[model samples]
Target: MSHSPVHPQLRLYFENPVGRLLEHPDGYLVVQYNAGKRKLEELKTFLTQASTLLQQRNWHKLLGDQRVMAAFTEAERVWITENWLTRSTTAHPYYGAVLLAHDVFARLAMNLVMNEARESGLVYRLFEDENAAVAWLLQVP
Candidate 1:
C-alpha cells in the first residue's frame, strides 16, 4: 500500500496490502480498505490485526471506510460474520460505522455480513459519507 498519510487525527496502527488500521484520537478504530480483489487469508489477517488492536485498546467503536473496496467473496463474508465479528463483540459493546462503496455488489455483500454482526450484538450503521460516519460513532458511548 502507498505510504501516504491518512486523516490528520488518525494514528496509523497497522497496514497491509488489503487495508490499513488506524486509531482515532477519540478512542475509536478506523479501517480503510484498498480497492482490489484480495485473498481470504489476506482479509483474515487484516481483520485479525484490527481485532487485536481493539482488544488491546479496549475500544468499542470502529469506522470502516470501504469506499473503494471490491466485493467480498462468499467465504470472506461468512468469516467476517461468524469469526471476526463474533469474537470482536465478546470483548466489548462494539459499534461500527461503515461508509459504503459505490459498487452495489460490495454493498450487498457487506450488508449480509453486517446483518449477522448486528445479530451478534454489534450496533452498526451504513453511511455514504466519512464525516457522517465519524460523527455518529462519536455520539455512541
Candidate 2:
C-alpha cells in the first residue's frame, strides 16, 4: 500500500501483506506485523525493507506491533525468535514497543520474546492500545 504523510515529519504505510510501518515526527519507526505462518522468505523480505529504512533514517525509536500474530506454527515461532527478535538488535533503535491485544497464549509468548529482546540494550514495552504505544514511542527522555 501507499504511504501517506501522517504528520509534517511522519510517514505511515503498510510494508507488506502483514505489516505496517510508521515513521514519526521525532525519528521514531514503528513496524507492525500480523501475518501468521508466513514463509520465512516473506518475513525476511519485509523486515529487510524495514531495516533498510531504519538504517537510512537512523530512527531513534522502533515499535513492533504483533498484536495480530495470534497463532503460529512451530517453524514460524522459531523463525521469529531467531530472525526478527534477534536481528532487531543489529538495527538498535533506542525504544521498541511490542503491541499485543488478544489471544492469551500469543500475548504470553510475545511477552517472553520481548523480554529477551530487551537484553540487547533497547528499551522495550508491551501495550494493548495504539495510544499507549504512541505515547511510549514519543516519550521524551
Candidate 3:
C-alpha cells in the first residue's frame, strides 16, 4: 500500500474537489463525494479532515452520500478499513449511514467500509436511498 500527501486544500473541510464536509442542522456531518473517481490521496485527505471535524464539532455521527462517488481500488479499501476507519473508531463510538448509489463499484466499496466499521464497533447502515439513510442516522448519537 502507498499514499501520497494530499493537497493542502483538502484540509479545509467545507470546500474540496472530491466533496463538501457539511454540517446538518439536525446534527452530524455530511461527506458528499463528487461525481468522479477520487484518487487514494484525495480520499485520505477527506478522511483526515473528516476526523478533525468529528472531534472539533463533538459530533458522533456522519452521513456519507455516495451518489457521485467513484470506484475505489482494492488497496484503497484496505487502507481505509485498516488505517482510516480504524482511526475513526472512537471511545465515544461513531455512527454512520452511507447512501449507496447505483454504481456497482461504489456500492462494493461502501459495503467494504460498512463491514469494517461493524467489526470496529461503529454503528452503521447502508441505504439505497437518501431519505432512509437520513432517518437511520437521525436515530444515532
Candidate RMSDs in order = 1.9, 3.8, 7.0
What is the TM-score of each predicted model, taking all chains together?
0.93, 0.72, 0.84
lDDT of 2 by residue, 59-119 (tens): 6577666666655545655666677666667544557766774677777776666666677
Q: State residue 71's C-alpha deviation in candidate 3, in Å.
A: 1.6
Best first by TM-score, ranked: 1, 3, 2
Best by lDDT: 1
Instruction: Give, for candidate 3, the lowest lDDT window spanning 10 residues.
Output: 1-10
What TM-score does candidate 1 reach?
0.93
lDDT by residue (50-125, candidate 1, tens digit) is 9899889989999888888999999998888888877965745799999898789999998888778878888889
Q: Give the candidates in order of lDDT, highest first.
A: 1, 3, 2
lDDT of 3 by residue, 1-141 (tens): 102223343333575666778777676888877776667887788878888889998898888777767877797788888887788767888888887766898888778777788888788877877778878888775
- In model 1, state the lDDT of residue 112: 88
Candidate with top TM-score is 1
What TM-score does candidate 3 get on C-alpha atoms? Answer: 0.84
User: What overall lDDT goes with each candidate model?
Assistant: 0.87, 0.66, 0.76
Error of 3 at 113 (Å): 2.2
